[model samples]
Target: MKTKTVYCLSGLLLGLLTACQPSDSNLKNQNVALQLQQKALNSTLGYDLVESLTVEVGPRLPGTDKDIQAVNWAVNKLQSLGFDKVYREPVQVPVWHRGQAHAAVTSPYTQSLVITALGGSVATPEEGITADIVRFNSLADLKQAAPESVEGKIVFIDHKTERHQDGHGYGKTAPGRSQGAAAAAQKGAVAIVIRSIGTDSDRLAHTGMMRYQEGIKPIPAAAMSNPDADLINNMLKRSDKVTLQLFLSPESQGTATSYNVIAEVTGSSKPEEIVLIGAHLDSWDEGTGAIDDGAGVGIVTAAAKLIQDLPQKPARTIRVVLYAAEEIGLVGGKAYAKAHQHELHNHYIAAESDFGAGRIYQLDWNVNEAAVNALQQLTVEMADIGVMPGNNEASGGPDVSMLPALGVPVASLRQDGRDYFDWHHTPNDTLDKIDPAALAQNVAAYAQFAWLMAQSEIILRPVAEKQSQ
Candidate 1:
């Protein structure tokens, strides 16, 4: 009887041990995953890598020699970083050059005014166009003016932006800068000059792309420096008979083929799902594209390098796309959308850092309720770093605008844009403008968020699709 009892007890003990064994193994695996993630998140070398790239390969305007050099630098750097696969996918980009740009008040009183031509603007004759200036407070005002008031005259659009992080003033005031030339041309104006659509009160003008209306001839477009704009504005108050001269020589050559350098640290498990981080590789020719996008490229590259060195990879692939010709337009981004349209659905989350290098203070995500809980938890993890949640109705940066339409979720680490427009698209966008400590903070925040998202089982639902449904 005693032997039989011993046998029954031994059988029960073995069964219990078997049941507990699998649970212990799962716990160990989970712990290992946590450690690996922590290791990646706490990387120091990764931060230095990004800093080095930004400092060494300053501006990379598409189609320019600098742009090509920047691409080569990215390729070599990624290879050196030991990415499993680093490749350059060819991207056809527009080639626009900013030649000599000069603007001055030739009449009413002679004065030298600072200015820069808008991207894709046609140049004036060698002697330049001298015309009577027609000033308007807004585009609507310009439209309201009589044809004779603007005909054969340089239309001056004077507007000012109130400083804000969301760049509300820019949105309102930028129309004159973008469409002013075409708008004035329709009314028979010889050329157009607008108050620089930037916040700085200094003598530095901002340059951006200008799109001409279909069938409308492109004309000379220029932005006066803020201080110059002020001088023009004060002079206007004193007299409406301000005459101006504009001289610009912007040429558009044949298209050039560049590449959006992309590399990935593939997932150990679910490789199909992608968490993407990117920035435009192209910059305006005025200065090194440091603040505009060099910082972004650096930020994304560093973030990914940190993840790559971890003992275990995240479940979803992390892709770094250094886009080309973002400064010209979304040319590179549009091309990317077209090339990857078939796989757009696979992009789980996409974030872009295009705004100037400012301390990131808020984070907004445009995902559905399914991932809201996860993001909320993530926000709690990032609160110590001054990152807070924003509205779910986010569409990402201008470069990745098409992705949201294709069901890719988008988010933003809303950097303080208070001082961004000051140096944005200007010659002041140099490496000295970047604050290292602030950049590192940005890196830490991005690293933590990206790792958490990649590790989490939840996926961010596409905002457009979610809204439609």
Candidate 2:
């Protein structure tokens, strides 16, 4: 009886050990598959995609004929790449045209100042408007100044942006460009001029979208080149009175139709669950839109293509979205959320790549507690490529930011954006700025994360509350 009991206990311990240990052969096969996919993505496929888009389609501003052409191009491209389904969803976008713009310091110094009209700004009269300049060091200073000090003046907000890898400086300084016009108008200023929200000290001005509050009157707004802003500051130090003449011919052309291009790789098992990857398609019309978003399109598209080519389909669908009118605002993103509100619960995970072709350095996520272990395992798999794990507070970029509000999980593969703002929305944002190696690195990181998301069975959100006994 004692010998029989010993044999039974030994058999039970052996069964438990076998169940706890992973099959080495299966693990080896998975590693080999991942290695093969990464190697292919780090090749020339990603670069070729960006090159074709930037060269063939060029800048695709929202609500323009080129925008339509871009939508068609993306559809054809995705179909050619063998996506299961490709389609376009219409989005109504505001059309704002930038005509001719000129600014000159007329009084203290007669010199032409490099400037570009901010998007959505009202047109200055054909003859132009000349006024004494009131310079403020920052937007907060402008807000605190007495109304009598700014009435009928050209308010200049001269806050400078700093360089940082994480791009926090752009967030800190962007408000001056986005809201300065409305704030100045509220204070009775005739117009507002701000230093370009860029890190470079170049002569080219960066132009982006600005907003006017509902009740606040719209006014002419522009961004001066960094060097020109410095010139204005120096002149203000010498003399309090610096008069300027500004002429801008921008006008709103009302609403126009744009599209969000979507393509998908169908899943073999759970077709209803989705892993979304996104990037914006519209640009500011200053350059070829190479680094701003053309790179992002290439990265995500190439990642999806790589996954689709695998011998076996993933467990969940991989959806790639090319959003529209992101430069103006997140119009396409907002429209997508509204259109797909009912199915948002099935979005297993979401991410976006809009911060240029810089190499990804860290991974951040906003998933459920139950999904944390899987994310940690993914980070370990990506360690060989120089990516580290980050905190859980992820914004998932501009296009998919609305998802988190609806309880959809999101992640961010944070890229090194130290020099992103230098050429952002400027004429300098051209194809020459992108490095092929960095672009390849971006594809590798994105492809790995996307694959993990599509393969895992982990539910990313809506953690069930513990049952009461």
Clashes of 1: 0
What are the per-residue Cα lDDT tens digits for candidate 2 across 178-233? 99999999999999999999999899999999999899888899999999999998
TM-score of each: 0.89, 0.92
Each model's lDDT = 0.76, 0.84
Which candidate tops TM-score? 2
Model 1 regions more than 4 Å off? 1-55, 462-469
| Candidate 1: tens digits of C-alpha lDDT, residues 1-469 | 0111000011122213111222343343334434433453455543465456656776666888888888898899989988877998888887888899898887778999999999888899888999988888898799788888788999889888779987667889888877788889988988898888888987888898887888877779888898998898788888878888889998888789888899898987878888888888888878777788877877778777777877778787888898988877788889888888888888888888888667778887777645554466444545556778766766677777677777778887888888888888888887777776677667766666666666654446536475423
lDDT of 2 at 175: 91
Compared with the true structure, model 1 gives a TM-score of: 0.89
Pick out the ten consecutive residues of candidate 2 with the lowest summed lDDT.
Answer: 1-10
**What is the TM-score (0 to 1) of candidate 2?**
0.92
